[model samples]
Target: MTKPIEVRNPRTGKFDYVIIPQSPKLLSQQCHRLRRGQIQWQELGIDGRIEALQQWKQALLSERDQLTEALINDTGRLSTSLLEIDSFFSTLDRWCHLAPQLLQDTAKNTSVPFIALQQTAVPYPLVGVISPWNFPLLLSTIDAIPALLAGCAVIVKPSELTPRFVAPLMTALNTIPHLREVLSFVEGAGQTGANLIECVDLICFTGSVETGRQVAVTAANNFIPAFLELGGKDPAIVLESADIDLATSAILWGSVVNTGQSCLSIERIYVAESIFADFYHQLVAKAHKLQLAYPALENGEIGPIISEKQAAIIRDHLQDAIAKGAVIHCGGKVEELSGGWWCRPTVITEVDHSMKVMTEETFGPIMPVMPFSTVEEAVDLANDSIYGLSAAVFAESAELALEVASQLDAGAISINDAGLTAIMHEGEKNAFKFSGLGGSRMGADGIKRFLRKKAYLIKTNASKDPWWFNEGESSKDI
Candidate 1:
């Protein structure tokens, strides 16, 4: 049975107004069942999984405003920010269309040194997901679907602030009765998330690098391998080269989208020497054009920072950036909103790699742009972080852009694109380095990450590999 818990909607400055379900144990057991392989995703096939995801997608669309509002209340995100729903749809629709084919295994001749053989990577089951509140519905559900379709079950837990969104989620699951039993939600603080780490077979986490470190430590201690989609200090490198318009849009949307709460949002902008002043001017101008207020429960441009604590943390980072001599180009202070969580959209310039804003995940509506001279310098500047989640380059030449992409330490890079992450691309997922561990795009990566490989050997020549079994008798018998 699920029990209701009164939770605060920090954005609206309200408490006990919204009730969330807390089912930590039941959620744990469902995950245990998935680990035991009682679930059958193979039977569902790609089409079936696709259909189910579509249903969920439709449900999200139907409840988009409510979900957005809840997230805004929780995070102080802007109303217009939920526009990530576009990318969310892109990812889900694409997954429904492509995950099965992409995730399917390829049989191959092993061509082992001594004998005729076959080799293939098989899909394993069940991935546990721990989602944060920034883009609550999309990240939570998209990460869950691929695993389920890969013949794995999922146990998902959203960050506490937006837990209220799950009620509508439960309603969406009504059509997929089988999944309703396997796909579960448990709402609480870090304890609930930590408990899930022990319960599931594998994990997929998207949140702060600090918390991600704790999860990693625990998972590592248990020898429980999992994926971490942690944090980002992604940079946008603009060469005097290219399309000013394209570069500007990329940087603006990439960094400030969702009020700069996005992991791959352009945390840093490196403009070419020639265009630095122009780009900075245009960028700041665009920042001013943005309509900022408390996020409307539905269509507002942005929302709150999830909680006062997160807002405070973001504030601290901003203050530190200012102290370090970084320029605050736009909205810098916390704003009081009526019935919603809110933060002013922010922009920063004159930041270097050493500043906290450039190193840590501020996760607020803030952007810090820097400038560099050459392609070589740009690459060095972009790769100078502990984070390698995602990066982008804006240059006229495709060859140079690809070259820069090859050199950067990041797991994913966008050519001629700014902060607009391609996470929902037809056959991909968010890339990572310090951002997270072990993930890929399309269908192969995420679900596959949860899978483990066990190589099987058959000896027709009667030679035991000497690892365990006798060469002739044991090999022949088997």
Candidate 2:
């Protein structure tokens, strides 16, 4: 007998529901059904698929309020949860408009002679998405929209911590007649995700670096592709000529928003040595001014970390930094907030690369600051990590920022701003180095990742090509 997956409120620490785990046998059966549905679903053609996706998006929009509420309860970040809803709608709109064109057949030129060829985009029959608890609804649903628009079935296995929001969203999606079996959700822990990966044609996972490696290996064993968006120790570089106030605010929010759980969150901050003191002072002051409150209050900018386990990790990193001579300029204690996993918005100075807070992903309300003497030094410091998902460069001019950004080892870099905008933009979400592999979240590339290309050749007349004849004709040139 499979154990029950308990759904708990991260903020309240109380049980919301108990979900009976789906056995591997049952999940495998579900995969077979979804694969069968995909055959007919793809045959419905692009127009039919687009109409169905549009209707599903409309259904999700109608339930925005209830979904937002559920997400807040699960994640405990109010403003970010609402912003996630807006972002979801935007993604849905973009995919609906762009997917059909992206997935259309392309006319290919024959390089050698008078041969007609066509390249067709064929989507995988089944895509398995293993979404993380952070930004659960958006991550789980956004990828499905494009896969469905490209005429593929999607099965989402969301993190157990996020079932509260995903369950309701799945119910709304099921209301669409054309998408009844085209999309499905299975709730469980790590083993279930492993089982799902084995059955799908492709896998897209978003989570920690350690888990991402395991997913990659599993996908490799099956000879299937896996898109992994792993953890990031993102750095923020504040140049000497930057607007100190803008730089400070951007870095502060980038580091603390979502209570600092974002993979793109600014973990290590490098300011030009000339402006280090001023930037550090302003950043700490602003961090102290942030309002920390419950979602019901609607006044909080910083909320609790997701769970006690995550809180423990944050605490360990903060302690490690403090022990290594890092100074806590402001806020560095686990909050005593009732029924919620809370951590204070913390800013630390005198940080070095030796500390875990500066080197590893500190996914909490903690910011570590360092100083660099030159642009090359800043680039070196930013790139000195095992992960390179995103980075930020703040300068007086876009030209200057771009010059430095061009040298950074990150997949996406923001100029004079934070990393949030980079991820929201249509063509920018990707990871470099150990951060990920083989896919993006937007643009033509996003839809194409779910598709395989097939080439067709046509002969205009009853003429046998020289290359197609016997080896005796190989000596003849065309």
Candidate 3:
């Protein structure tokens, strides 16, 4: 199944070079000896790993503009949105700085069979993180930083769209002497990616559920573990009690950030019907204030969609929503003029659960806004999606917002803010989601995903008489 792909660059409309590497079987066999505990936990501790990633961080900072530009070329994201890469770098640094303390080896006495029982959590070896291009640098690096800090090397299959940065990233990583050989990068088209997954102990995948499910299935078939960070139909709720100005800014940041390419992008915006028309009018008028420039400089506020195919998908979703009697309040066009992947910031009205725009993950700059009468209805509407990855709610009262936040079924919830869940739970004891399975790329989620616990029971007394002497067992030994 592993085959080479014919690569092309859309910017110049030219064909690129070919790349091939070891198959999944060979990679798996080679890694067989590199399991957890193969290396001492303290040998390559968090401090050392952080020291190395700091260099990686510096390299990322030094080339931030260039790297963002590369991602822009591939994803058609605004140059300004490219600061998202900077966000990733900062988060990586924060993870490196924080995770060592979180991953400290600790033991506990087990209450179960409370007889001289102990529970210990240890670091495992390398994990395979298959990150997607939508926000590839951030997603992959977010997971990788924690894993490395937890004493595991990572094998990353970066999205093919922005794979250009792999060499630069690996080069930067090489400066951290210890990780030069341990952390590795391998690139290939579709099947070659699958090969990489077949080998690693754990797989942290951030992509479509379809692809994520396949990764989990493939990993499971081989008895390997997997972390599936699939897509989301994230929703933003603007209540009757909301601050219009705050909601306006939050929605713009949540939806248009990265041209709405992010998994947590606010694809669904629900405003209380009492203020629906007013909010819709203001949101559209405010959007005009933001603009995308031509041959755009790096870090531009808006960028193109990743590809013509992605644009077409966005178009189809728009057209389908409209056909189903939904209304397009703002963007609905696919611009061929940019000679790049571009779709305007979209806002849809009169949407319902039946429309794909409402029910499925668009993963584009499409915001489908609707109105509800009560908090009960709004909460239900937001939780209607199969994807429970993230949500945002804006309310006037802190008490009411906290009450609502407690009720919403999401991995992360934002009160009076959007994408706040992306930052919350730092140093908190609780996991972000009742369902997201915890962790916000790092912190508790990072530790839970990367650390597997082993329970060890040691007898305080130097006797095994209890089990050995059962029903005349071991009589000959006595």
How much is 124 displaced in model 2, in angstroms? 0.5
What TM-score fits each model? 0.83, 0.96, 0.87
Q: List the residue pairs that clash in candidate 2.
A: none
Q: By summed lDDT, which 10 consecutive residues of candidate 2 come out lowest? A: 420-429
**Model 3 agreement with the true structure over 226-327: per-residue lDDT tens digits:** 767777788888889788887988898888876777777888998999999888888887776666544644434666666456777787888899899997
Candidate 1 lDDT over residue span 208-269, tens digit each: 78898898988898777767788888888888887877777668778766667777788777
- Between candidates 1 and 2, which one is better according to TM-score? 2
Off by over 4 Å in 2: 421-423, 468-478
lDDT of 2 at 259: 87
TM-score of the candidate numbered 2? 0.96
Candidate 1 Cα deviation (angstroms), residue 45: 4.9
Alpha-carbon RMSD to native, per candidate? 4.7, 2.3, 3.9
> Cα lDDT of all candidates, in order?
0.70, 0.85, 0.70
TM-score: model 3 vs. ground truth:
0.87
Native-referenced Cα lDDT, model 2: 0.85
Total colliding residue pairs, candidate 2: 0
Question: After superposition, which runs of candidate 1 have C-alpha atoms over 4 Å from their true positions?
Answer: 1-6, 17-37, 40-90, 103-125, 294-300, 339-341, 426-433, 441-443, 453-478
Put down candidate 2 lDDT per residue, 120-181, tens digits, no spaces: 87889999999988788888876787888888899999888877787668778889876877
> What count of clashes does model 3 give?
9
